[model samples]
Each structure stands twice: as structure tokens, then as C-alpha cells.
Target: MVKVQQSKFVASAKKLTQCPPEDIAEIAFLGRSNVGKSTFINLLSNHFKLAKSSSTPGKTQLINFFESIWIFKEEQYKMRFVDLPGFGYAKVAKTLKEEWKKDLWEFLNCRSTIKLFIHLVDSRHTQLEIDLQVSQMLEKLCRGDQSVLKIYTKCDKLNSNQRALLSKQGLLLSTNQNLIKSQHGGVETIRLEILKKVFGYEG
Candidate 1:
């Protein structure tokens, strides 16, 4: 059984070279600004302070790495969660925003440790042009063996019927857009899905 017991902040990298040596599998989170990526990190750690959650969009301007301890049927493994800078609508200078975009593309194309990409979409709205661009870029950059998961965040605000309707949308077929709320059982469900992806667990 795979179990994530604890997670801790590791380091922030401005570029791929600055990232810690690629020694283990990494799951990177990518999304638009204010899409609750940081909150998802905290949820995975089960520690409110694990990843900084800011009210202001674009506060995460670098690749933040969080190391977690994974126990799979008593065997320990080290895994990483990378919080990539959000792509759109950051309150930064145009030049800086472009630089962030460049760095993100470089990281995605060059990083060897990345096993999966967790792409987050705000469930309250339909997909945006940036989201499609991201999907296209990942399709080109990620290796054939790599994986991607599409997650719709802040699903608690939607009614059951809305969620059901959104879940069946053609665009959400890959990861099935399982609507996820940050609070309560939703976080745990998200975490478990992540583990399922990592460990190839059916349970």
C-alpha cells in the first residue's frame, strides 16, 4: 500500500538548472493564476503551512519543490511535488511574465524527472485559450511514456448536476475532470488519485 506520511518544503528553482538533482519521480502542478495550485499542495501534505497560499495571484514566481516521504507496503521512496509558476493573469510586469513563460517551457521540455503533469482548471468557468495552449505544449514536450491529469478545482461551489454535466464534457475525458473541493474529503480524494497514478494502484 502506498502511503504519503509527510511532506516538507525543499527548494525553489528559477530555472531547470537550479532545481535539485533529478533523483526521483516528480509530479508537477501547472495551471493559471489563482487556480488553487498552492492549496492543492498543502492538501497533499496535510499541512496548512506546507505550501504558501496567497490571495494575490502570481505570488508563486518560481518552481517550488516539495519533498515527500512515500511508504509503499513498508518500502520507503522519495517523491517530489513541483509547484510551477502560474501562467496567466499575474500582476507582474509584462517582461517578467514573459520570462516566467519562457522558464516554464524550458523546464517542461528539459526536466528529466517529471513523470506526470497535474493540470488544474478552475471548475467555475469553461476552459480558456491558455489551457488549450498548455495542453498542446505538453503533448509536444512530454515524452511518450509520461502522463498528464486534468483536474478541475473548486468544485464544491457547483451543484451535483453541474458537476455531473461538467464531468461528461469531451475535454475532460483524459482525467475525467473529477470536480475537487479543497476542503474536507475532496482533498483526500485528490491525494488518493495522485497516489493511484504514481503507484499504478487500482484501489
Candidate 2:
């Protein structure tokens, strides 16, 4: 069975300067507030509190980090998860919101350890303008080594035809359901894809 052998909060930072200087592989989780990013991370790690979830959106202002080790059969891999602050709809003062965006942009474009960007979008609201902006920003800022994965959250709410359409669109979609049988084990599939990106496909 695939399991999170070790998962712990590492640190929280407001900017790249304040972040840990480790050069290890990192996966960045970013999305609009209330998009289930924290819950998705929890499901992936099998540690519910590894990333904090808030009833009110935009509660996570700082960039939170988590170090985790995963064991699947005989293979083990270590990596960091960077939970970026939610943007766009945050109910912050306009002045402070600008500053937050500045810090977030700097972190996203300058963080060298980030091997992949997991951009979570709510499946029900797939046409949101904010998500498109974030997707554009990721594509524009991504380097040769970094790739972006857009996983749609709450996919179990979608019907089979909608899910099939999303699949046909060539988008990497996933659900936050903890069940291994849900949506063909979507969460586990995402975990394995993340592991492959971090450690290569040798295992």
C-alpha cells in the first residue's frame, strides 16, 4: 500500500528570503481560497493536519511548508510541499492584498526547488477567470525544469459525462476523496504522479 511514512510541518515563510534554503525536490500547491488545497494535501499525505484548512477562505497568508516521506512497496522518497497563499478572492484590504500578491509572485517565479506546481481548480467552477489568470501566470513563469499539473477538486460532484469531457480535454483531474476507490483512486493516482516527478520513473 502507498502510505505517507513521515509528514511534518517544516516552516512558514512570507517570501523567498524567509523560506528554507534546502535544494531538495518541492511540489507547490496553489489555488484560489476555499479550493480544497489543504484537504487535498492531507489526503495525499494521509495526515489530516499536515496543512491547515480554514472555514474562511484566504486564512493562509504565509507560505507553509511540509516535509514528507512516502513508502510504496520497497521504494521510499522524500520531498517538500509548498502551500502557497490563496489569491484573487481573499477578503484582505486592497493595499495588503497587493503586497501579498507581490510576495507570492516572487516565491513562485524564484523558488528553485519547486519541481512541479499543482494548481488546484474547483471542478464545479472550471470557468472562473481567476483560475485562468493563475494558469497563465504558471505557464508564463515556469522554467524548463518545472511543470504544472491542474487537478480539479470535488470531481465526485460532477457527473460521468462531465468527467469524461474533462478527461477528453487532456487535463489532469483529481478528487480530494480519501477513498482509494473513488474516481479510480484519483488521490492515490495524484500521489504516484507526484512521486514519479520527484524521483523519476525508475521505481
Candidate 3:
């Protein structure tokens, strides 16, 4: 089993160049405002308070990096998880939004240590225009490397029928083959899946 041993805040960067040097593999989370990105990070890390969760949208304004140590089969591995500012519906100044967009683009394109990019979508809604736009961008950027994963969040809000339907659409995480809904095994499933994909962890 893969267990998170230590997780702590690393650095907050407003621009790509200001980000810490590429020393360890990083996995980034991108999504719209109030999409539970922060909550997801905290849950997956098994550290409920590691990432601040707010009911208000646009609370995370910077590129927050968390350095975590995971032990898999008695071996230690260090990884970074980046929480980028939300894309749509943030009640922030237009200029701030533009700056965030610029920084995000640079981080996605220039970060060599980024091993996977998790694009989160709300399970209660269908794919939106912003999601498509981001998908196209990832297509151009990631090319055919399979470096992108679309994760449907808040699956507990959906009924069994809805979850089954979503699964048919291939909206579920491939590693767990289920909906990552609420505070359950969902977080652990995602954590292990990411480790398996990025670090070749058997669990």
C-alpha cells in the first residue's frame, strides 16, 4: 500500500519562473472555482488541513505547491502537488484573472517535472465550454502522451444510476474504475491511482 507519510506547504508562486526549481515530480490539479480542488488535495494527502478549503470561490489565488512523502512497499518517494487558481466564475478582478491564466499556461507548458495533470469536473453537471477549452489546450500541450486525466468530483451527490451512467461515459478514474465521491475511499483510491500511474506503485 502507498501511504502519505508527510505533507506540508512548499511555496506559493504567482508566476511560473518564480516557482521552485524542478527537483521532484509534480502532479497538478486544475478546475473551475468551487470545484472542490482544495478538498480533494487535502483528502488525498490524508491530511485534512494541509490545503485550506473555503466555501467561497476564488479563495486560492496563487500556485500553491505541497511537498509530500509517500511510502510504497517500504520505499520512499517524494512528490509535489500543485493547486492552481480556479479558471471560471471567480469573483476576482479581470487583471488578476489574466495574470493567473498567464501563469497557469506557463506552468503547464514549461514545468518539466509535471508528470500528470488532473482536470477536475463536477459530476453533477455535464462537460462545459471551459472544460472543452481546457481539453483542447491539454491536447495541444500534452500531445499524445496520456498525461491528462479527467476526474469527476462530487460523485456522492449522484445516485447509483447516475454514477453508472457516468462510468459508461468514461468519466470515472481509470485506476479505481469508480466515482471519487465525497469523503470515503474515494480519496485513497485517487491517491493510489496517481502513485501507480506516476511512480509505478503496484498498490
Candidate 4:
């Protein structure tokens, strides 16, 4: 059986060279700012504060590496969750914002350790231009060895019909306990998908 044993914050990187030694496969999360990337990561790791969220959007300025351990067939394997800086709607200046866009493209297009891209889109607004563009980009950039998993965040706000329709597009998630189950998706599903993708373990 495959089980995501645990996950922890390893380090933060401002640029590609500053990232820790790329020794293991990585599943990077990419999403627009305020899309609840941090909350999703925290839910998966079962560490509420594993990734910090700010009242102001786009506070995640660095690529955060969260190391996760997997137990399968009585053996342990490792993987990393690369939290790339959120794109769009940041409170930063124009030049810095433009710089961030370049950095993100470089990291995504050139990061060799990346085996999968977890693209999170807000459930309420699935057709945002930036999200659509990013989705297309990831599809183009994906290689034979890589895959893209698009997930919808904050699905609790969606009505029943909306959630049902969204379930067909991809995964739907909400960190809010009172409304998480409404989406019919949760942390375990996300964990299993990551394990299957990066470690080739389905259980």
C-alpha cells in the first residue's frame, strides 16, 4: 500500500540556483495569487501552518520546498512539493511583478526535478484569463515524463450544481472543515494523486 507518511517545510528559494540540491522528484504547485495554495498545502501535510497565508494577496515571493515522505511496500521514498510564487494580483510594484513573471516561466520551463505540476484554479471563477493561459502553457510545457494535475480550490463557495459540474473538470477542494466535504474531494485524494505521479504508487 502507498501512504503519504508526513511532510515538512524544508527550505525556501528565491531563484532556481538557490533551491536545495535537486535529489528527488518534485511536484510543484502553481496558481494565481489568493487561490489558496498555502491552505491546500497545509491540508495535505496536516500541518496547519506549514505554509503561511497573508491578509494581503501574493505574499509568497519565494519558491518553498516542502519535503514529503511516502511509505510503500514497507519502504520509504521521498518527494518535494515546490510552492512556486503565486502569479498575478500581487501588491508589489510593476517592475517587481514583471520580474516575478520571468522568474516563474524560467523555473517552470527549466526546472528538471519537476515531475508534475499541480495547477490550482479557483472554483468560483474557472475562466480567468491568467488561469486559462497558465493551463495552456503547462500543457505545452509538459514532457513525456511529466504530467499536469489541475485542481479547483475554494469549492465550498460553489453551489451543489456548480460542484458537480466542477467535479468533471478536475479535483475540487476546500480547507474549511464545515464545507470541505461539499466538494467531494479532500486532502487524501490529493496525496494519492501526488504519490501515484511522482512515486508510481497507486495505493
- The best candidate in terms of lDDT: 4
lDDT of 4 by residue, 41-130 (tens): 877766788888767778668889998787767878788889988878788789988887788788888889899999999998899999
lDDT of 3 at 12: 90
Residue pairs whose backbone atoms clash in candidate 2:
none
lDDT agreement of model 4 with the native: 0.84
Number of backbone collisions per candidate: 0, 0, 0, 0
Q: How well does candidate 3 score on lDDT at residue 198?
A: 76
Model 2 misplacement above 4 A: 170-185
**Candidate 2 on 10-103: residue-level lDDT in tens?**
9999978999986789999988888888888887777897888766788669999998898887777889999988866678788998898899
RMSD of 1: 4.4
lDDT of 2: 0.80
lDDT of 1 by residue, 84-130 (tens): 88877678788987888788888888898888898888878656898
Worst 10 residues of 1 by lDDT: 170-179
Q: Which should have the higher TM-score, number 1 or number 3?
A: 3
Residue ranges of candidate 4 with Cα displaced over 4 Å: 1-4, 72-75, 176-183
Candidate 3 TM-score versus the reference: 0.86
Please write out the lDDT profile of model 3 over residues 60-150, one tens digit for every residue. Answer: 6789999999887788889999998887777878897787787788888888888888988888876799988988898888834337777
Off by over 4 Å in 1: 72-77, 169-185
Alpha-carbon TM-score of each model against the true structure: 0.84, 0.90, 0.86, 0.90
lDDT of each: 0.75, 0.80, 0.77, 0.84
